[model samples]
Target: MESTDLMKKINSFALRSFRDNADRDYIHARMAYRAQLYPQCFWSSLHALEKYAKCILILTRTERVRIKKNNFDDVGHEVLKSLKMLESSLNIILSQQTIDFLKRLENGARFRYLEVSWHSESAELTILDRAVWELRRYCNSGLYSYENSPEVKLLDNVKELLQDIENVTVENTHIAGGRLEAILKQPKSPARKELVWKNLYFSNSKRKTVWLESNFMAENSSLFLYPEIIDELTKYTRIPKEIVNAYKNG
Candidate 1:
């Protein structure tokens, strides 16, 4: 959901940057789809998770979610830019060096890594988790900069948002990079899982659906898919009555 709005903003930014691309429409559609699916197909897909996991940079903003570590010391965005560029061409077109570089960065889980801390990698996983969560939140909230303008105080917007975040002094809060790794290693929830299905998707109508039921067995990343969600999705496959009865009856 955050990515949906983010895709629009990113496209707007691209338009401003490129002025015009001959293949603007094609690129736009691809970028938008990836903006939504990259996290799912490439990153969230356990089968393919490792393929992009190393490229998944953990970013953090102390004042606000806008200031990338790169503008200061954060470089994760740069990695994302490069990887996205490579992803633009799915074929053997992006060059081997580019792929190699990304692979190296990903293997170390230190590639394109960015954050504000001049601290130790103590709570590496925990810090990584926070960084991912922050990026997700950033995608949801929005980022702003005065790069093209002046008289703007740096990190002021972040300060504004920080006023609202209920910063709790929870346990393991200061183990440095531990947070980030924790988030990175954690599994994504499946679309048809219990929390997702029961909380946001499921309804009496969902029961009669059949498409999801059919595909449930076909999904590659069923780990995120909750069994309860699968059961719920069986109800809403949109299949005809005979199948629905057999499904509900059986």
Candidate 2:
């Protein structure tokens, strides 16, 4: 499809929907992290960040935003670059640690392939949680009050958009913040500390044996979805079990 026609298919309402999709990605990332599916976690986190960045660009940039297929034009799968563009364009700064985390995620294929890699214990997920929180804040603000430029107004549904922007109220997704915020900002609990330790060295034979023997595995049993890990994540992230189960079932 032509880029302009594609842009016409997207509007402020579609832009607002990114928050919901990103929230689901955020939830999935945490679930994968809890499940010790680090590769999946990395991809999910990257996806969540990419969507948030694109959403931000759509809201703040006056230029035409081209989304061909599932890939953002000139920004395919490189979340760090997308975020840098967002930072430069919107003057929204991110911490050096967050930048480093996104850089690590940029090579997510390595993690997926189980190649030798370096990732911090708990810190990766924490950075994702915090970054998502900040980005979601920008999205919510833009959704409710952005004055679309004349160029943006060319997109379909812009005329009907945000009539109730003042009435916009987001629920407590991981981005909207709750337990995840507390976990990010406050001290960790003993279970959380242990979970982090286990995640850090999940390759240890003894820990792996115990972890496998435990009932933490998902319904398939081969996937090894740990309940204790989920509990720890829930303690910190406050994602509902239904959402976690949705990820598990699908």
Top TM-score model: 2
Expressed as tens digits, the lDDT of each residue in 71-140 for candidate 1 is 4333331334433432322111223443443343343342111110112222222222222222222221
Clash totals in order: 41, 0
Model 1 CA deviation exceeding 4 Å by range: 1-105, 108-129, 145-155, 160-250
User: Candidate 1, residue 108: CA error in Å?
Assistant: 4.3
Clashing pairs in 2: none
Q: Which parts of model 2 have CA positions greater than 4 angstroms off?
A: 1-11, 14-17, 62-73, 109-111, 115-122, 141-250
- Give the RMSD in angstroms, all C-alphas superposed, for model 1: 21.0
lDDT of 2: 0.50
lDDT for each residue of candidate 2 in 165-209, tens digit (9 for 90 to 100): 222223322233323333334444433333233331211223321
Highest-scoring model, lDDT? 2
Error of 1 at 131 (Å): 3.4
